[model samples]
Target chain A: MSRAYNFSAGPAALPESVLRQVQEEMLEWQGERASVMEVSHRGKAFVECAAAAERDLRELMAIPDDYHVLFLQGGATTLAALLPMNLAGADATADYVLTGHWGEKALDNARPLLRTNIAASGKAGGYVDIPPVGEWQLTPGAAFVHYTPNETIHGIEFRDIPDVGDVPLVADVSSNFMSAPIDVSRFGVLYGGAQKNLGPSGLAIAIVRKDLLGRHGRALPPIFELQNQAKNDSMFNTPPTFAWYVLGLVLKWAREQGGTAAIGERNRRKAELLYSAIDGSGGYYRNAVAPAARSWMNVPFFLPDAALDKPFLQEAEAAGLLGLKGHRAVGGMRASIYNAMPEAGVQALVDFMADFARRHG
Target chain B: MSRAYNFSAGPAALPESVLRQVQEEMLEWQGERASVMEVSHRGKAFVECAAAAERDLRELMAIPDDYHVLFLQGGATTLAALLPMNLAGADATADYVLTGHWGEKALDNARPLLRTNIAASGKAGGYVDIPPVGEWQLTPGAAFVHYTPNETIHGIEFRDIPDVGDVPLVADVSSNFMSAPIDVSRFGVLYGGAQKNLGPSGLAIAIVRKDLLGRHGRALPPIFELQNQAKNDSMFNTPPTFAWYVLGLVLKWAREQGGTAAIGERNRRKAELLYSAIDGSGGYYRNAVAPAARSWMNVPFFLPDAALDKPFLQEAEAAGLLGLKGHRAVGGMRASIYNAMPEAGVQALVDFMADFARRHG
Candidate 1:
């Protein structure tokens, strides 16, 4: 069967080449004794696989020599809890910039564990814009300044990394990871769930500055301890071996496609194509997000008539454009064009949208 | 190349059929629009897949209507931390039965969260025996009694489920789940990491009694909350959807293989064959654990001359008997024959062991 254009926000589309390669190696990885999933994490083959993945990712992001890349489980939500435990030194306030749902949710997760203060909030405008860095109220001597660079649900993204003024800046880049080049040295940490731009679900990646670790010692759960994970090579416990391996494959694929810079251009083009389609609809369709803050990864838009939503979705699905239904938090439609979504897919989507708008306008 | 006999504890072997099925459907699931990994967890397809997995697990284990099955992430280690926060009522002392490394590690995790007491210990015997249940020191009004039914590293397994006498009993069945038929009503909670005896890594399943939930209020992280997970259908956050789907496939395979009882019987036979080979080695090879406490899933044995361990492992790998090298904690040889390991694989390992013993004796 021909593959459909998958535009789901996350656990989203992987490159077709990677999927085929994974399928080929599903039963036996690299002509090894067993599948990558079947092998031990401590085994030579998997350890090498994991190391290669980290190395490729580091090279892709141009991560500084002092950063530690960790393959973790439980996704980004669990990472939110771990962030405070590992980085938010006891009694230090954790400053969060709430741009959208994920930032708000992350703040909620961190609240119980740390004394937290919102440095900035874009919620007043229903998360359609990012408050400029100049306006953010930075906390004095905060353990870390946290923000979501790309909020998947609200389709908001930061145009540039926030300046936290000597405080460690951490970003939840789950939505926009690998879609563009990131200045790894500017931030103390950046983490994301692997399902979106990386590979599959069940694994998370944390590129954290080395010095920020081991501060809390062994008081936290060993798996939640970034220092311990980095020290033990992310095998403190059994990692999601299969997912990690897939992430490696995806990273390798991305590197072959000329790394994040080239992919970023393609992502920008895809986002522009879809956004142009929405804007060109002559008030028939709309994206509530501000142009400056619009995400290159997730494009959320709505039809003029609410009653047409059902038929639009049904027709979209029938046309082989899948997972276009928007997040329930902001109802309408979302076309998530991550690194794997080619310009052709966006063209296909734009073509469909134009045809649909012509008939339904 | 033909598949080797994978003896790794976990990220262990899955049924070849399941692997093939997964490979075939990696790009598109059930003729659906996206790979199960790409699809949203809240989508109709995944919800059905999760429900089917739960239903199959319930049927296989004979889980009562009062139980809520949860497919969680972050393995057993995370669950250990979740237990105290979820189960232990305010200021209640949680009871732990220390059998091996995992039990001790779990206790360590719980200590920071709650007042915990070692209800029993196998440490005195170097983790080679289960201190009989009758001898356990039950804490008065203990919130819950937690134990490892099988310590994968120590190669010790309980012959029968322990009775905690009206207190909630939680078992970490990571190494032996689905390898045997479990009476779900015998405990308040039965959870296991899926890498062993179930499916791939990254997913853990929890079978918890309904009445034992919702004790803790809004204090805990929502992802760790069992009631919330159940209510949201384990979509509390983006789950390890691919892992969860693979788990469903594994459960379906187990059911097709005539449910847990049939699989358990086969596991018993595999254990007996491997153990008989070890016992028949006439002191040339030895297993330290008490015979009555031997695990049906993990069979660890040591050669009389530990010097030959390296060559034995190398030769075993060359012979397509993979991961025969025992865990570093207990160095020698371990053949973990979970539900996925065919009887032929165990036979091959036994044959290899006999040959090795004869040559090196």
Candidate 2:
């Protein structure tokens, strides 16, 4: 059966190969009598799979040896609180550079838990561009500087990591993870929800510097303790084994597709092709994000006439391109071409976009 | 593929039909071109699935209309902290009846967060029996009385709920959820990890009375706030979509098998058959749990000598009765017969037990 080009921002598209593999392994995993979800987390098969997932993720990202890669639950939104809980002292200030909705949300969440300073904010500019790094008013003795590299809601992405001198950097890469290669050493901690560019929802991955652990200012739940989770290899509790297994399969597929570097190039091309379609639509289609800040993973665009938005989405769905509607906050259309979206899927979306523009423009 | 009779304590066996259905739907769910995992949580399909899962579960358990069903992450372990975070007021006392490892662990996690009183402890009896209700020393002004209905590690279960007047009753029913009929009205909150009788690990369900929402005394992460979760139908953040889908399928299957009442009867028979085999083994097999308190879900037992443990496990594995080895805390053997285990699987275990006894008795 043919599959639709699913463009969901998260709980998004996954590699067809990974889904097929999971289907085959549903009843029996490597001759084991149960599916990976049915097996024990401490069992050899799942343990090996979990290890390999972390190993491959490290290899792909070139994570340093001093970093602990933890497969956790609660997603990146949960990580907003956990990052401060695990990294910053109760009395210390944590600087937040708010690029879009997520960073602002993170700052709001961390406010009651710790002292926070808005290093910079792009909200005044309508979340259309990143605040210039040089203008950021960072706290001199801040615990860490947190940022969101990409905002899924408005399709804002930072092209480069901001230089924070000796201060540690933390990022929420939920929308752009594995879409490109990243410098793991530049950040003290990097985490993302495993829905885009990874596998499913509910599971999250946190890559933290080893020394940054065990320093939380207060007693936290064991699940929120990074050191405890890292020491136990993210099995501090029974993890989302199925999501973790699916992530391993996606990682395997990512490696086979020539790792992050190759995928990054493909993602760039997909973004360029779709953005070109939007730019050439002669005001028929418009994207609010600045040209330099356009996210390669999530492309949010608007139609000149809001009345036609419904038809565009209806026609797109009829043509087998799905989930192109923008987030409610953005209120337009978005095409999230994650790693799992082949160039053909982007081509399908672009083809539908052009056809819609011609019909409605 | 042939399946084994898996007896794992958690992340346990699911109905074979559910697994097969998941395999069939792995590539495409219904007419949607993506697997359920690949869809947006806010999408109609997933929203419907989540609603139906809660409905079926409510019907199976006879949940009252006033209770809100929340699909969450972090498992029961996370619930330990969340229970107090959401339920107990600042400085309010909460009583715990320590029947096994989990209850003690919960108390330990809650101690710094709130005032906790241990109403009773079964540790004095080696976790072999439940403390009598008359012996409980509950605090008069306690916000809640928490208990674990079944101790997975030691195969101990309370045959009846302890009467805690005025105070809310919370239970961690991870090991025995959906295995039998339960009076939903009797509980203030009933939470369980969805690995044993529900679906996979990582996802948890909490059925809380609606009035309990927004009573949290302390600031909490949005994800940890049950009121926020219930208000948003547990989509406060991206949930474990695949686990949630699989749980829907499991719930559907459970309904087809005559709901919880019939399943409970079947579970009882399976436990009876397995326990009888151990009891009639001519002093060769022994179970530490009191006969009245023995869990129909988890049956932990020992052999005549410790030396036979390895051989017994090896033989059981060879005979396709996998994961029969007991928890590390209670070293011997255990056969967890959740609702998913068919009568044939239990009969196979019973037949194997008799044959082994004949040869080694």
Of the candidates shown, which would achieve the greatest TM-score relative to the real structure? 2
Per-candidate TM-scores read: 0.97, 0.99
In the order shown, the candidates' DockQ scores are 0.70, 0.77
lDDT of 2 by residue, B70-163 (tens): 9998798888888888996669899999989888878877886788889999997799998889989989978889999998888988878778
TM-score of chain A of each: 0.98, 0.98
Whole-model lDDT, model 2: 0.89
Cα lDDT tens digits for candidate 2, A1-361: 6799999999999999999999988899988878888899999998999999999999998999999999997799888888898896789899999988898888877987899899898888899998889999999978999999999998999889889988889999998997898898999999989999898998999999998888876887675678889889999888999899999999999999999999999999999999999998888889988899999989999998889989988999999999988899889999999999999999988888888778777
lDDT of 2 at B287: 87
Note the clash tally of each candidate: 0, 0
Query: Each candidate's interface RMSD, rounded to one decimal?
Result: 1.4, 1.3
